[model samples]
Target: MSTVEACEAAQTCWFSCRAAALGGQTWTDGPLHWIREGAEQNLMFPTRIPADAVQSAVEEARETGVQIIGAWLGTEVDASALAAAGFERGWAPSWMAAPVADVGVSDDPRVELQEESNDYSDEYADYAEMLKLTRVRPQHTWYAAAYVEPGKAASRKLAGPRFAGRAWSHLTGETAGVFDMNVWPRFQRRGIGSGLLRAVVAAAAQAGARDAVLNATTEGRLLYETCGFRQIGAGITWWLHLEA
Candidate 1:
């Protein structure tokens, strides 16, 4: 598969895990899969783009009466078509990947890494609070539960010392997708984030993954690059706000 296709598949798997954790239903119409969160909103992701299906997916999202609709268009999809459909292109995150040997390692003594337990722990709670503080999402507690629960079964959860930060790497076949890399505000600039990333990558490699992939935010572009991850493709998410 192409890098874009591989990245999209990995992302879809991660989203599926999150949706299952929340007991949400996933439905597919044509090439698109709608991961609906009750009536609050819907995540419309296209596994494969057929001609005109993108526009139909947008129409379906509007008909759902969802106040906000988020979609990630693969590199092969035409972004302008979605824009013409009234979906505003928001932050476009870069999809990056690197071979196991290229992933950098950290030798910082203060940075200790540990695997998370199946049941929730104090570290998980602190990590959720840290995500809330950094990302400014007060509802991250629910999101955290969705991520942590699925991760325990299908991914590796790596935590830094004193729960300063954490990251998750989910592997399927030979590709591993990294997600939920968060660091406490107080722990910023202390190499904890990098340390956690190194640990996660190492775990993926040891688990027999040939490569690792992640969608990097603007704030994390440099860090991922520093760790030998290079942009293989890009994805654009369009946000459509509907009338209540």
Candidate 2:
């Protein structure tokens, strides 16, 4: 697949995985459009929509009872169409990817990465706590069994009691997409985040994935870049607040 196509496919898989884990829903309104209803009562346009069809998608998303619309800008997607439709562009993240061969695994002794089982009980609780720390109010149930680094006992209250860093990857054939990576504020810059990231990428590679992709926040762009991921495209989310 072309880099652009890979990037789009990676994002599609990432959003779908999140929706499944969180008890949300996903559907496509045709091949060019993919929508996700996140657990937080937010709508996600994870793929590109034709410029002429943007307004219709927004209208349809409103019927799902979500208060926020998160639309990602793909190649050839017109940003002005979104603005014209009452969405405000925010949090322009970078879509990045790397060949599995380029990712380096870190053997950090201070941190241990654990992949949760399918049950996801422990991982979900840890993720909930992380969301709480960030003040995110999720309205629907969400769960994922992914990579996590158990925190030290003494740091339980500040970091999650069971995890200091969390991340997950979804494999779509030969391509893998990484999602929801975060390090507790108390544990930031201690190398825990990078270690967990490397571990997850390596895990995907072991699962027969040749390429790895992720959408990175501004603060995270450098970290992924240092780990050999290059920017393939832009993932811009336009937020539209619903009227009460």
Q: Give per-residue CA lDDT, model 2, range 82-171, as digits (tens).
A: 788887878877888898778776576544434333323674663443332112232111122223445465465555334455676667
lDDT of each: 0.64, 0.63
Best by lDDT: 1
Q: What is the lDDT of residue 149 in candidate 1?
A: 15
Tell how far residue 54 is off in model 1, in angstroms: 6.9
Q: TM-score, each model?
A: 0.68, 0.72
Can you write out model 1's per-residue Cα lDDT over 128-241, one digit (the tens) per residue? Answer: 333322132221111111111122333344532244556777666677788888776756776667777777667666767788889999899898888888998888787777
Superposition TM-score, candidate 1 onto the true structure: 0.68
* Each candidate's clash count: 0, 3
**Candidate 2 — which pairs collide?**
21-143, 22-141, 22-142
- The parts of candidate 2 lying over 4 Å away from their true place are 30-32, 38-53, 109-162
